[model samples]
Target chain A: MSTNPANHSTPVNTAAGKLAVGWALVGVPLAYGVYETLTRVAALFG
Target chain B: MGFLDRERTIAPAGFNRWLVPPAALAVHLCIGQAYATSVYKTALVKHFGASLTEIGLIFSIAIVMLGLSAAIMGTWVDRNGPRKAMFTSAMFWTGGFLIGSLGIFTHQLWLVYLGYGVVGGIGLGIGYISPVSTLIKWFPDRPGLATGMAIMGFGGGALIASPVSTALLKAYDPNSGAQGWVASGDAVGKLFLTLAVAYLVYMLFGAFTIKVPADGWRPAGFDPATVKAAKLVTTENVSARNAVKTPQFWLVWVALFCNVTAGIGILEQAAPMIQDFFRTSDGASAVSAAVAAGFVGLLSIGNMAGRFAWSATSDITGRKRIYMLYLGVGAVLYTVLALAGSSTTILYVALAFLIISFYGGGFATVPAYLRDLFGTFQVGAIHGRLLTAWSAAGVAGPLIVNAFLDAQGKPGQLTAASYQPALLTMVALLVVGFVANLLVKPVSARFHEPRPDRERPHEPAMEA
Candidate 1:
């Protein structure tokens, strides 16, 4: 049903590329937060 | 036509564009509840026999974690999709409440911190960013209003949470000489459990309803290339890494930090400031603690209203213009608040409301501005990085307000008039913010020029 050539270049692929980069940026911070939370919880149990 | 036939005729991959804003609003409203944490502060402190510093710590922890979590989860929203992020947010948010309920029942401080501060904080971070990048993509032409509509919900969330939490605590009161609830831990537990269940239902609605538009979607008549040409704003489409290295990024960071630090000083101790003001002035001590609660509620309304009104205004006037208004007019209001002192209650409420509105406007307008400068490419991630400013303000704002108040308190006079000194300090911060806003120039054309020599084979052509 799609007729426009513009649809072909909608940058959906670009979205994926951006997403990969975004995830990499956040990955370290997320891991650190998880570690901090886990350690705090562990101390509670210990 | 059959229902299945009708469904097939609609865009198969793309969401109904109309549905996206409402879905964004739903998530924001639920997460916005974090602003209402102060409503529980006095009760928690009284019940637990904790000091003001300890009680304040709980909120500080939640806020610090909110910034940290947002910075971390922003990338996840970009990669995994909003659906996954929203779902995860709902679970953690609900679980935090449940755990908090248990903590209240058991009389455990650490449990409460873990439940609300860490778990719920992560939920806030994830939920906050879920709709932002998607909304910017959906409405490239009017990115300000699109992001604003969702964020406005967040600013207003406190408006709903405050009065509602107050009523619930009242209803659940054990009447056994307990200030708010029965002194028993069980009563407190039940109250938190009820709040958890309600929030879970609301947040689930948001999670299920959210969807990103199909790839390459734009408005019917809009041309992407035309947009790139029209605004000399940040449209370079740099990766987050490259964005951080640019001078424009640090300028934005300074602007956000100054704006937030100026606003939060007033917000953190609003109730005490009002009470002291009234007590020292007229002999009418009849306003009571509940009236102060109502004042906070009213401020929440202003906060929510400003998010929508000012941000929507940015669409017409431009983001830079609105920020100037927030800083310039906000500075004037702070001056009036300081000089007028407690002489007029009407003036106090009006001026406070104005300041709070600017505070809320700063938050709403920033995402649209980010989109203008950076393009939608990894904007949510960039916005997350920018929130480190908020973390700094969280400490700086409270420190400025409290330190001033403490210095005044040391005289042992301890009246509402003591707040005058703090108000003056806030005025000075706003003046600094005003100068920073003026210094913000559009990114230089040289910075926008793509070095073809350095371009990766896969990188899109830099917008000229």
Candidate 2:
């Protein structure tokens, strides 16, 4: 029987990549919030 | 179906703990729809030909149920990992939206209440607490900051949902008349449908991605000995049932109740409060609806920023001192707003912003405060019980504000002077909370669970 390499956990940079993904998840929403606020503020001034 | 089982939800040694916040955020952002109920309040009232109070009851039920379910479900969440809990939350929340849509489409108001209020509120409750204990375990070094990020999503969820709900309503009824811009019950029904579909998918990300940290896991290089436990900060653990038996829990409850009630008083009527406070001399209003909406938008930012910033500050200043600032300084800010708010627009916004920040701070810091008093043994459950303060405040806060305002005159007809009574009342409420905060001590030793022989290994060392 051949052991599937993809099925096994590798001692590579996994946590860092997961951590970066986490930051991106939060960042997308935060960036959208900024855009929403900016437009709302513009409407107030407009 | 087995894909989301608990075996899949354990954090591997090399797994990034940071991934947990966004998972929590995903659930919170969906449940936060509870805050955006006002968007549909008018349309529902028109559809049912009911009083504004009747429509308002929908939101009230949801908030009440949220508190109840959280208290009830907290222990279950603590016992099970976040995966099963979040999956349950997603199902109920999505089901609430779908059933609620059916109610609107069928013109049955009770169905809306049962669907959105009862079922969905449970979703909010479980969803709210589901990720909390996980975040605390993951960020043992910064529990306040971690929980704040997720809870902040609860505050900001309304911000995202409000606009999306409005846009959907507009698309559903582009030719809406002047008297009713939200279209009608049919549009609202469709809106609920869209929301249910979108949220179910979004919440799946959280349910699938979230994992409980391995038992006894701590952040790297962080020592438990380094945290000098103050007299108020306990080193022991207390079960949720035992936690309720402590004087400290009740004191913290009173503190949270007062803080939420006062802040919610402002939050419930932020737009009208500002407009009424600074009404023009000639009788025309100074603040426009657009401007009021803008103000609400700005308050959302303040609420969100305060959650992250103040809770992070609590990590440094100590949870007790940050709360002291929330209750103590909160009183001062409210008083200033009451007195000077009538004349100075700048002071009004500035003071209101500061007051709101503290309000948000109270929410973000309290979980960490609970951890300080009761150990993580059942912190989620205890926090669940603690949120009843918010539920009670949800009713009490708006009542205090509205009752005072109505006694003076109608909402729009009243002047800044009319708000003085309510504002002053909030200051007094803050004083009560401040006293409660002062009285909080460590949970007594009687409540501590005897240390077990072997920590319950949730894992069985089997391959899934």
On a 0 to 100 scale, what is the lDDT of residue B52 in model 1?
A: 68
- Tens digit of lDDT per residue, candidate 1, span A1-46? 2447677545455545544543333233223433433343332123
- Residue B445 displacement (Å), model 1: 6.8
Please compute and give the TM-score of the first chain of candidate 2 against the native first chain. Answer: 0.55
Q: Candidate 1's residue-wise lDDT over B1-464, tens digit each?
A: 13212122233453345566766766777777787776577667777778868767766777788789878777666776666777788888778888877777777878888998888888888888877887888888778788877888787566556556666766676574555443345555666788778777766665555566666777888877765654535656655555666666777677777778877877777666677666634544424556665566556666767887888898778777788888888888888887785777778878888889888888888888877777777788878777778888989988887787787874334565677677777777777777776766665444443545664445433442
Task: Look at candidate 2 and tell me the lDDT of residue B444.
Answer: 58
Question: Docking category for candidate 1?
Answer: incorrect
lDDT: worst 10-residue window of model 2 chain B: B455-464
lDDT per residue for candidate 2 within B69-134, as digits (tens), equals 999999998887788889999999989988889888888889989999899989989999988888
**In model 2, which runs have C-alpha deviations exceeding 4 angstroms?**
A1-17, A20-26, A42-46, B1-7, B174-180, B452-464
Please give the distance, in angstroms, between residue B133's alpha carbon in candidate 2 and its true position after superposition.
Answer: 0.7
